[model samples]
Target chain A: MTPDALEGALRRPFAEPANDRVLDAAREAFEDVGIQRTTMRDIARRAGLGRATVYRRYPDRDAVVAAVLMREVRVFLTWLDERIDHIEDPAEQIAECFVAVVTGLRGHSLLNRLLTLEPAAALPALTVDAGAVLAVARGYLAAKLREHQQAGRLRSFDPEPAAEVFVRLAHSMLLSPPGCIPADDDAWSRAFARTHLVPVVTG
Target chain B: MTPDALEGALRRPFAEPANDRVLDAAREAFEDVGIQRTTMRDIARRAGLGRATVYRRYPDRDAVVAAVLMREVRVFLTWLDERIDHIEDPAEQIAECFVAVVTGLRGHSLLNRLLTLEPAAALPALTVDAGAVLAVARGYLAAKLREHQQAGRLRSFDPEPAAEVFVRLAHSMLLSPPGCIPADDDAWSRAFARTHLVPVVTG
Candidate 1:
C-alpha cells in the first residue's frame, strides 16, 4: 500500500472523550510517578474516575505502558513515512527521516518522562522485544531503502545491511546520547546522514 | 618511546593477591549469585578465604567490582592494541579493533548477569566510573588512526569520529547482537570486519 493510504488509517479525531481521557490519565500518571510504580488507582485519581473504570480500559500496568509507548511509536513512524514518502533523493530522504525521527521521538513529553524517570521500566519496552515495538521502525527504514534502490538513486548497497546500521545507530542514540546532539536534537542527524548515510546509500 | 619501550613502561604485575585475587573473587561471586545480593561472605566463600581477608584486599563491593572490571578491560585493550599496532593499513587496523571489541564484549556474561540479577546495584558501576575505560580505548584507537593516516592507507578521516563510531558499534553489538554472530566467539569477525568496519573506515 502507498504511504498515503497507511497514514490515512491513522487520521482520527480527538473527539472521543473516553479513549482520550483514558490515554490522558495514563499519560499523566506515568509522567508523575512512572510506569512500574504508578497504580491503576493513581491513573483513576488523575482522570478523576473510578479505579474499576481505569482497569476496564487497561487490564495491567504493562498493558497501559505498552499502550502509551505504542501510540508514540505509531505516530512517530507514521510521521516519518508521510514526510519521506515524497522526497525523491535518497540522501535527502535519510536526512529528513533522521531529523523527523529524532525530533518527533524526543519531543514526545511522555516518552521523555518515561526515559528520564524510570529507564529500567521503560527501556525494555523500547529496546528489547525487537519483534514488537521496533518492528515499525525497522520495516519503515527497510522500505525507504528499497524505494531508493528501485528509483536508481541509490548505490550498490543492500537495504537490509543499511537498515541494520540505522537501527543499531538509533539504539545507541537512545542509550548514551552525546552532548553535541542537542537533546532538542538534529546535530547527530546531520552528522550521521551527511557523513555515513549518504556515502552508503548514494551512487 | 619505541613500541617495546612503551610496552615495558606500561607493563606491571598488578597481580598482587590483594588486587588480582580480590578481583577474581568478585567476578566469581558476581557470576554465581547476584552482585547486589552477594555479600562479603559470598565472595570469601567463593575465594576460599575469610571475610576479613576479603575486606583487607578490597574495602567494599563497589571497589571490588570496579577492580575486577578494570583488570579485564586492561587485558582486552592490550590485546586490541597489539593487533592494531601490527597493521599497516588504517582500514585493516580499525576493522581488527572492531572485531576484537565485538568478540570481547558481545555476550550474556558480564552485562547480562548484571542486568538480570541486580539491575539497581550494577547500573552505577557499569557506567559511572568504570575505570578509565573510554579514555584508554579512545587513546589506543586514535593512535592507530593517526598511524594509518601517515601511511596514506586511508583518507584523512577524523580519528575522533572513527573512534566514536567504533565504540557505538561495539555497544550495539553487545546490546542486540546479530543472529549470525556467536554469543561467545568471534566466528563472525571476518564478515563484520568486511561489511561494517571496512565500509566506514576506508576513506
Candidate 2:
C-alpha cells in the first residue's frame, strides 16, 4: 500500500482527528525516543488525546512503529523514483541511487535514531522485510543496466550482481559512514553521486 | 607491540602448568558470564587460585579481558597465515579468509558473549581507541591485495577501498548472518572463490 493508504487505514471514521494526531505523535515521539521506549501515553499526550482514544486507534507500540516506518519507506521510494532518471548511465544511476539512498537517510530522524541510537530494537523495525525494498531498487538498476547493454553503452556484465553490489555498498556506507559521508550532510548526495556513484555508472 | 610479540612475551613468563590453567579458567568464566559480569575473584576461584594471586598477575578487570582478547587474536592470525598460501589464487585466498574467519569466530565464546549478551558494553571496546584493531585488519588486507596485484594475478584497484569493502562485508557477515551465508560453511571458502571473488580479482 502507498503511504496515503497506510495513513488512511489508521483512521477508521475517515475524518477522526484523534487518529491522525496519534499517528503524527507516534511518528515524532518514536523518532525522538525509540519504539521500545515510546509509550502510548506519551503519544496520547503529544496528540492531545486521552489514553482511551489511543487504545481506540491502535493496539500497541509495534504497530505505531511499523506504520511510521512504512510511511517513511513509501515516501523514500517515491522521492527516489522521481530523481533517478537524471543521470544518464545505468551504472551511474545505480551509484547515484546508493548515494541517493544514504543521502535520503541522513535527514531522517527516525532512521538515524534507529541506526545510531537503538540498533538492537531498531534493526528489526527498520529492516524487518528489507528484501522487498532491495528488490525494488535492484529491479530499477537491472532495467537500467539492460537498457545500457542494449544501447552498447557499457560492457556485458550481470546486472543482478552489479545491482547487489550497489545495494550492499549503500548498506556499508550507512553502517560505517565514510569520511565523505558528510558532517552537515549538505553535500553527501552530490559527493556520493560524483565519486562512489560515478564508478558504478562508468564501470 | 604486535600480537606476536605479546604472545611471545606472555608465553615465556606464563606458559607453565599453573598460569595456563588460570587463563583457561578466565576464558571460560568470561564466556559464561560476560566481561562485565565476570569478576576476577570468580575467575580466581574457577582457576583454583586465591584473589590475591589473580590480582597479582592482572591488575584490573580490563587488563585480563585485554590479555584474553590479545591471546585469541594471536592464535587466529598465526593459524590463518599458515594455510593462507595453499589457496594459490588471490581470489580464493580472500574468500578462504572470510570462511575461515567465520569458522574461527564460532568457537569464540568471549566475543560471542560480548556481542549477544551486552552489545552496549561491547561497542565501546571495539571503537574506543581510533578503531586500532580494524585499522590493523585493513592494513593486512591492503598488503595482501597489493601483493596479489604486483604478481599480475589480480585486478588493480585502490587497495584501501577494496580492503574497506572486505572488512565491511566480513563484519556484516558476523553481525547479521543471512540465509545466503552457509550454515555448514565447509565449502563456503571455495564457493566464494568461484562465484563472487574470481571475477573481481581479474578486474
Candidate 3:
C-alpha cells in the first residue's frame, strides 16, 4: 500500500474486521515468539485463516508487522484523544499527552517484548525507519496545537516545529529511556512538560 | 577496563602516545574499510604495532573500538569547553553547546561514515549500549549547568535530567533526523535551544 493509504488506515477506525483479526494474530505471534521467529504462516495459523488469505492481504511478514504497528499507533491515538479531550488548558493537554504516551507505550506488551527480545529488529522501525510513525504523531500534535492557537489558548509560533520536538523527545525517551528522567511518573512528566515543552509552543 | 576506569580515561587527556597511535590507526581503518571489515590485525598493521602489542593493550577489537569512541568523546568535550568557555550567559552557552555538538558530530568523518555505511553496527553503541556515552555527555552538561546554577546565572533544577534531555534530543536528531527541524543549521539550532532547552534548566 502507498504511504498515504497506510496513513489513512492508521488514522481511521478499523473498517475491516478481517484485517483487525490478522493484526491481532500478528501482534500475539510477535509478542509470543518475537518478530524474528514469527512468520506469515504463524500469523495465519493463529488467525485461523489460510496462508494464502493472509498473503493476499499482506504480501509479506514485514507488511503484516507494519500493519500491526500502524494499528497500535491508531489505538494509542484514539486513547490519547479520549484522555486529553477534557483538559481545557493547552499546556495541560500537552503535558498529559506526554505522560500518557510515554507510560502507555511503556506498558504495551507487544512493544515491550519486541524492544526487549528484538531490539535490532525493533530499533530501526522506531528510530531510523520511523518517518511514517513520526509524521503521524507530528500531524496529530500539530493539529491539536493549531486548535489551541486558533482558540487563543496558545501563543502563536510555528506549531509544526514544536510538535516535532515533542514527538522527538517522546521518541527518544521511549527508545533509550535515560536513567535521569522519571519518565514513568505522571507528576514528573507533567512538570517537565510545563517547564521544557509547553514553552516552545507558547513562545 | 572497569566502568569507572573507562569513565576516567574518557575524561582525562590522552596520556599514552602509543595508545593514541593505535586509536588513530583504528579510526583510519574504520573510516577506510568500515567497522565490520576492519579487523584488529588491520588496526595493528596501520598503527605500525604488532598484533600481540595491540592485543595486549586491548583484549579484542570491541575494546579498541570502545577506546577509540571514548577518545572521540574526550575530543568533543575538550572542544566544547573551549567553544563555550567565554560565554557569560548560561542560556547562550547552552545554545552554542547544542549547536557545536550537533553540527560537530554530524561533520565527524568516522561517525558520519559509520552512520551512513554501517547503521546496524553503529546504532547499538549509540542507542541501547549508549549508557557510557550518554553518561559522559550528561556529566559534562550537568557540571556546566551546575556551574551556572552556582553562579546565579541559571535557575535551580535537577541538572542531570535536563542534561539527559539535551543529550537524548541530540542523540535522536543525529540518529533519525526529523524533517521539521533544520538540525544542521546553526541559527535554527540556537533558536531551538533558546526556546525549548534553556527553560528546563533556567526554570
DockQ of each: 0.26, 0.18, 0.48
Provide backbone clash counts, one per model: 1, 3, 0
Poorest stretch of ten by lDDT in candidate 3 chain B: B1-10
TM-score of each: 0.74, 0.64, 0.85
Better of 1 and 3 by TM-score: 3
User: For candidate 2, lDDT tens digit of each residue in B123-165?
Assistant: 4343232134444555556667777778887666656656655
Give the Cα-based TM-score of candidate 3 against the true structure.
0.85
Model 2: lDDT of residue A193? 43
Name the regions of candidate 2 deviating beyond 4 angstroms.
A1-24, A31-37, A47-74, A86-88, A101-164, A178-203, B1-27, B34-78, B101-130, B179-195, B198-201
Candidate 1, superposed: residue stretches over 4 Å from native: A1-23, A44-59, A79-85, A99-109, A126-131, A179-192, B1-20, B40-71, B81-85, B93-100, B106-108, B116-139, B178-189
- Model 2 deviation from native, Cα RMSD in Å: 6.6
Per DockQ, the best of the predicted structures is: 3
lDDT of 1 by residue, B37-145 (tens): 7788888887788899889877988777766765666676676777666777655665566666766675438776675556556644443342244444445565566
User: Considering summed lDDT, which 10 consecutive residues are worst modelled in model 2 chain A?
Assistant: A1-10
lDDT of 1 at B142: 59
Candidate 3 clash pair list: none
Q: What's the true lDDT of residue A19 in model 3?
A: 83
